[model samples]
Target: MHSTRPFLRDLSDSRRKGWEDGLRDGYAEGYFRGQAKVIVERTKTSFPVRKIKVLYVSSGKGFPYSPIDEAIVETLKTLTASVITAETKEPIQKLAEKNRPDLVLALDGMDRPVEQIDAVRALGIKTAIWLTDDPYYTDMTKKIAPHYDYVFTLERNCIEVYRGLGCRNVYYLPFAAYVSHYRPTLTRSAINRKISFIGSAYWNRVEFLRPIIGGLMEKGLKINGLWWDRLPEYKQYPGGIEIGKWMGPIETSEVYSGTKIVINLHRSPFDETVNNNTAKIGALSPNPRTFEISASGTLQLVDSREDLSSFYKPGVEIETFSNSDELMEKVNYYLSHEKERQQIALRALERTFRDHTYNHRLNQLFGYIFK
Candidate 1:
């Protein structure tokens, strides 16, 4: 009877453990199903006029935190889209299936792996890939071009490249600023001698600026950015120049307003020829810095590109330079001719207000999508 009692107790414990495990599994399954039902129900509602549900996938690298996330969300709100962001491809696909959004926007060049492309495509949703960087070095176009409904490139040369690659739909959408965020303040004050450039250090930019440092210094230019740290100790020059670490988007815009002239130099790694389909020598692409600096109502001296004339009337809206000599000359000319500099800045502001807002881009995007 004693032995039988021990065996009976063991059997009872095993049965109790099995029942608890079953309960836990049932709870998990129920929770997932409930969550999925909510997502599906939310997606089923009728979208108001001009409202598109956009699923934007980002690697969540630089601006994944709350502040940046909030800004991106706010920008998307202007489009009246229910914006959802995900970091991984699997979750994004799952969301895409559950939500069945009208459109999917991928932030970087390559947001999904090759394996998941079929899953996303299977959803029968329109996919747009936003290329922030040059696509030449990456296999984004080669691997995923066939799956995308449309490809929007910041580089103009990419239109032809993607078309050649059998992407029937390709558009050249240059980088733009949120006009509401980056705009001229009503009060204009005297300019101090602060000059800044904001971007990561790249080999091409470092090499290009090396020979021109002396010219810039001779003209009393105060240069700042990440390039200072990358310079050799012996070659590095010191003086009134201020070097800044990475600045957030808001801080960067504030810096633009405080400075007298903001110089925008494209890094070699991102230059048009390297990543664009245009002939290496003839390739021209304007980075977002052009629009951001101009929108802030700050005087800008940008590296000259042939395509820039298409966007803004050269010598009227903004000034450009080809080499170090040309850059220094423009810097001096603009500084001495303050009225002309202000005029160009104002023209840039006007042009951007009329044609280059994110709203404008969204309109164009939707037009193409519906067409």
Candidate 2:
């Protein structure tokens, strides 16, 4: 025998080790499976089948498109609601009269007529209006919002303003992304841009971007939006740089997917050129782009806002910048650390799909009002 005792001992030890490892791995796999099952059950329970007839009033497609309006309507459809859409005041009345829906929802009601609202309420159906830009259009909104049965506002801080206007059923409804319109890409886009910004060239944005323009361009920066090209101040960029036009929702998602870092500069309601009044300047909540960029599966670098943490965990899910210098510093750092950037982007995308989709928002609305 070739040392039979030693050979037997070695074989026993190896088998013991293998069994322990297998046990550990099997336990982990079983635990994760249980967790996943729980999550699926929770999701199934959250979305109960709800059927209601709704008449939707929107600005419709053209210049200054409202993707959020489209998203809300689409999400309602998934809830088994029969929806009839109207662009303007005239069609809204005609549709409401023909359909006799159980409820009427007017989205972005700054352009809606008070007479039309009265006409819909005359049908003995409940009327609701969701304002995308709350304090920005409060002067007109305060005049009309009190007439509706329910009022939903994107500006959380302005809930009291509607209440002050003697509206009883005001609710805080935040902005969200349409998951289908914005998502991650498996393959990289054909474009070569590294960092991108897509927003209107408001005064604060123009001024904030001026300082870091040269440095960001050296590291590859691309910007696209309305009025960005028309601005003379931004013309000083390097020869290859040019401000591009506004993109549609899907094209905007494509730009975000192609970039490494998507910089989001929120509009100041005080910027009269943009918001017409500075009343809600202190209100610092994120705009729709904040969720859209995260949903696009790109690392988002946004300006510091008070309510950002309620949506994303800064420095973990997304990065925030208070000034141009900080933004430039982070841009360089994140670009060099590819693994960390990708991890954050992945986490953000997961969060967006789990909590910030339009489907989730619509469910919240229905749960609150319908209950």
Q: TM-score per candidate, in order?
A: 0.75, 0.84
Model 2 segments more than 4 A misplaced: 1-46, 89-91, 229-233, 238-241, 278-281
RMSD of each: 22.8, 9.5
* Model 1 collision count: 0
Q: Return the TM-score for candidate 1, rounded to 2 decimals.
A: 0.75
Best by TM-score: 2
194 in model 2: Cα distance from truth in Å?
1.3
> Scored by Cα lDDT, where does model 1 land?
0.65
Please give the range of 10 consecutive residues that has the lowest summed lDDT in model 2.
36-45
Error of 1 at 332 (Å): 1.2
Q: Which lDDT value does model 2 have at 18?
A: 77
Looking at model 2, how many pairs of residues clash?
Answer: 1
- Compared with the true structure, all predictions reach lDDT values of 0.65, 0.77
Across 1-371, the per-residue lDDT of candidate 1 in tens digits comes to: 35445554666777867766777745743443343234323322122246678777664545423333344456666665488776653566788898888887766635467455557778798788766665444444556666687888777766777788788898888767775566654433233444566675566666766776766666655555555666553244576345555666666666676565788887653455446423342347887788878776667888887688878887888888888778777887886775677667766766776677666666677778876
| Model 2 score (lDDT) | 0.77
Flag clash pairs in model 1: none
